[model samples]
Target chain A: MPSDSSPPNRRGLITLAWLWVAAPLAYGVYELVHKATQLFTG
Target chain B: MSSPPVAPAGWSRWLVPPAALSVHLSIGQAYAWSVFKPPLEAALHLDGTQSALPFQLAIVMLGLSAAFGGTLVERNGPRWAMTVALVCFCAGFLLSALGAGTRQYWLIVLGYGFVGGIGLGIGYISPVSTLIKWFPDRPGMATGIAIMGFGGGALIASPWSAQMLASFGGDNDGIALAFLVHGLSYAVFMTLGVLLVRVPRTGDGGGTASGPSGPSDLEGVQVSARGAVRTPQFWCLWIVLCMNVTAGIGILEKAAPMITDFFADSSAPVSASAAAGFVALLSAANMAGRIGWSSTSDLIGRKNIYRLYLGVGALMYLLIALFGDASKPLFVLCALVILSFYGGGFATVPAYLKDLFGTYQVGAIHGRLLTAWSTAGVLGPLIVNWIADRQKEAGKHGSSLYGLSFGIMIGLLVVGFVANELVRPVHARHHVPAPREAADAQRQQPA
Candidate 1:
């Protein structure tokens, strides 16, 4: 966990905060893996 | 307890509600996606289970994004948060449109699941803590007003999406066009929230509780986001929400297919339009659950309302399992009530957290706690879909496949019921003293 007391690196922290953008994107990618594989097999 | 500190100068508190309304309305569209399910499945020649992917992914993303974004929303305030939500939500839709148009299923998942999910999470928490700050006196009503927007989003989105699809026609081109429109429309709609929201002045944060309008003003207490997570009550309530949501979703995800399947071999099989009506009815129940049952939580207390959700919800599943297709009205009525409780479960939980934890960082904590919801989102659909799949392979037909699914839901709810009963007040060790209290304690300690 990032310490609460550190000086707020506004840009860096904002980037980190929004990095959760990856989670859903990653999950979406993960969920469709089988279909992608099926495309090749077919 | 002392009255919350007064607001700082020049902050416009009232603007917050509209900001909340914007996000809730847009994210709420998730409830209405089923309106488009049939045409998409037919157009794409996908299986019933495959058709459910986009909606399921959207929901899972909703919980995940919300859980992850909870704290950032607190630090950045509603404006920044709302902006993030708008961008992601719109982008998600656009991506999904591209995916649909080209027939690449992965794109739909990318657009809606990852992109749109972030929008759901950020939009969800954007106004939560700020609203609490604005209406310290009436946390439930404040949160309810905003959360209700989410519940009602589907009510608006369902008819609107249906009409759009109807006009556009059900080909891949049409569906993709509809998604593009949804993305653009939501972007426009959510702009209202971004422009209108303002944090309350720091000194003004006290005493505006809204609810059943009688003696139990305590219905909407405020708990800070951080303090809430430290308490066992938060986790216990988290279990209650996950269980309640899972139960309702299990039925909801399969409502149309289940109904049609149930009546297929029977004398009074459901027709196409009536099945459409069934989906609409479930939407109504889902919307009503957010407003009706959540508002009711003010009078009954959070625990008691959850008790109703879990206990009554379990019985509703049982009725469906034992009775089979005996009475359509009974099934519909029970399903509606259960869905309402599910919606209520979502709308009222923030208020319940307020009552237990106090509003210091309630929004952030609420966001964190939403991980439970994310977990339930996946678990709920997986349980329902997986069980149904196995049942189909076993040659189970119609409502019989649902029996095992509903039975599993019942067991889950039972465990949730126990968890609710176990919730108790926090001990002193977990309590972080307010700034004033900490200052006073320091003065009294030996030098």
Candidate 2:
């Protein structure tokens, strides 16, 4: 078994995961923005 | 816990959640059913209920397929499960497109509800156990991140579908085109998950090792899926989940019209456009709550968080029933909080199951539990809509039309609150003996 320390690259992996999460979330936000613009402007 | 296949060096346990998110976000489009309802009704000459059949059937199938395919998912691993989900989900859309082009409503139901729902079921559970295994220290937060994608999927799809319907013209051809695009796009999107996902090995520092060494490991009795179903604990959770979902869906399924009706007589009356905006806000609340509230469970403990979801959720409903139309902001606040609890209830349940059943077959048990969601899907809308329709016929207007339904929702939440209180740890007899138990026993023996 490996030692009981945290994984060496744990931070990097978490950063990558955040990137993955951010992509779709950005798209969702964009959609929401568009809808909000329409709701207010129109 | 059964050991996962060894992951290679440089593989991050964090990658698994994104993989799970990919599948969830795609299948979560099921919540955007209302986007297609108007166009389907126009083209098919159907009533409101008729147009709703495809989505309703899809939910039913989601629960059924999850329950039935859960064990297979556990055995075959996430890649196999995601691949099956991708095929069924994409194919369902394609078939629905074909059905729309041919003007066969039954075909749409069959494709989206039956076949696609199978995909939803399998795909929904596919990554759950894997995630719980990967993030043993923070199961609630881990599952929350992925399932939140499911809640947010409709946010993307609703606008996208509305645009497609507008561009294509709201006829049979337009609906078919929209369906085709959804299938093709999602198939491409879901492939990312299948490729990125990997199971961690036991004691590989991905959070599974917890006996004497790891301080963060979950200490609990493990129960198999079959054993879990027979337990009173499982049934109590089932009722809790069902009631929670039923209450939320009662408002969610009718968000737009219900709000319009509620404020129709007010000085600043709600317009159709404003109602659409209200739906969007509810979706935002639903999506945000999935991640926010479920992540909170990791801090507060799953049982304590559920008390908030069921207990406070009932109070929210009561507020809405009593003071809804009197003040619009209060009504919106109550509804938003209620919706959030609904989303939290969904995102928290997998971790709750992990706490009770162990990671060995948590995905399968979660699959069985989702039948509660299916039951709620039917019951929630039926109770709310049936009462609303009868009130309309009687010429009742505004909040009065929904007062009775909200009252019923309050009752359901109370039942769920009781069920949540009744939940206890699984019995030792139901727990599967850990493989390491025997090895540890042997090692401890004196010569």
Candidate 3:
């Protein structure tokens, strides 16, 4: 019966969900950026 | 099991993307399989072609299985599909670990290619429709968020995997251990998706999905998967996807070699390190395009965006062919744009399907359309590889090696551009009856 309302604990879970996926994605991006910088370096 | 539990009232729609990402990011490791090839070839004493067999077969199985398992996903739900994908994919890795440890190359092929490929297929399409349902307000962005993970998967897997190989040593035991680690770690990561995912609650849940804001340019009608293939719109989109993918993937598959060849005879020959950088850069562009251009499609319309991908994309190919070596910066810019279009072409198609067919069975329909990708996977590389091999035989080097291939890709783009032009809304005869009408008719008949 509620619509789009998140309890504090549920909000924490949502944050974790996003972070769970985002952290790996960010790590991948970091590695890619490190490699990609070499194109101009040479 | 029956379908996974639907979301309770007030359950956040946002949870769905991570679930999709969990599956996609894991399966996306297929892109990084090249990292395993040299090690596998060295340890197993196989040729380059022989080593590539598992990745190639995995792609083939991805297409076939996705096309086949789509309806099952709609039947069993995302949690079930994710779990199955986790099992099959991880099991494939475990089997490959066993194979590598034992020096049985065939087992690696069976494990990684056949078993894991099914996981790739099923896992890939599992969350697509759910995302569409959740964010009908922005279906393009919804799908893009998850599908982009498939492109980005390699970025994460490639470096971590290389480090693992570097640390563990690239011997048979090392490779087996790496595969074991991947299987176990991915099992844990993907399980999060299975647990987090929930279908949207239907009917008197007090909260409705509410937003169905697909493109208004079309008739905006519903068509089941069966009726979808029967329409000309499907085949036209299929051809459009095929040609677009072939052109893009052709370059992607041969990227490092192609860039090196393009500049080999020139004064500014690309170094090996720079070439690796170029490949990494392309991966970035590819990953960015999935989220960026697909989200743009939500605003600009799918047909209009395909116009950009195919139309501008052909011009970029022509530029690369004629003047690629003239400037390194220019060449990189053109190639980057082309790769982005390639990635964009992939991410945009699901929304395009929703536009043409509506979301009735869009996942199944998308699965069927992926056969184009499977076809392109073979055709794209074949066209480039065959031509390059012939050129090598003739002692052709540098940009000349790819001139003919580029020309052929331009023609493919033209064919795709024409196919995009041919797309129109589905005809009224092909429509599934509106639910209210079907329900009304059923009531009259039963009495």
TM per prediction: 0.76, 0.89, 0.93
User: Could you give the C-alpha RMSD of every candidate to the true structure, in order shown?
Assistant: 11.8, 4.0, 3.9
- Position B70, candidate 1: lDDT: 77
Per-residue CA lDDT of candidate 2, range B256-327, in tens? Answer: 899888889999888777777777778888888898999999999989998998899989988888888898
Among the numbered candidates, top lDDT falls to 3
CAPRI tier of model 2 = acceptable
By DockQ, rank the candidates, best first: 3, 2, 1
lDDT of 1 by residue, B1-447 (tens): 112222334334444565687678778787667777898788888887877787777777777777767767765666778888999989999998998899887898788877887888888887887776666555666787788778667666766788899999999999999999999988887877776666643234442221111111122333455666767888898898889889988888778788888778888887665665676667667766776776777777878988999999999889988875787778788888888888888888887776676665567778888888778877888998998999999999888878888899999999999999998866656655444533443456479
Cα misplacement distance, residue B28 of candidate 2 (Å): 1.0
Task: Output the worst ten-in-a-row residue range by lDDT, candidate 3 chain B.
Answer: B209-218
Ranking of predictions according to TM-score:
3, 2, 1
State, as a TM-score between 0 and 1, how close model 1 is to the true structure: 0.76
List DockQ for all candidates.
Answer: 0.02, 0.34, 0.55
**Candidate that scores best on TM-score:** 3
* Candidate 3 stretches greater than 4 Å from native: A1-9, B203-220, B434-447
Q: Which digits, one per residue and each the tens of the lDDT, describe model 3 over residues B176-202?
A: 999999999999999989999887664
* DockQ of candidate 1 against the true complex: 0.02
Model 2 local distance difference test score: 0.84
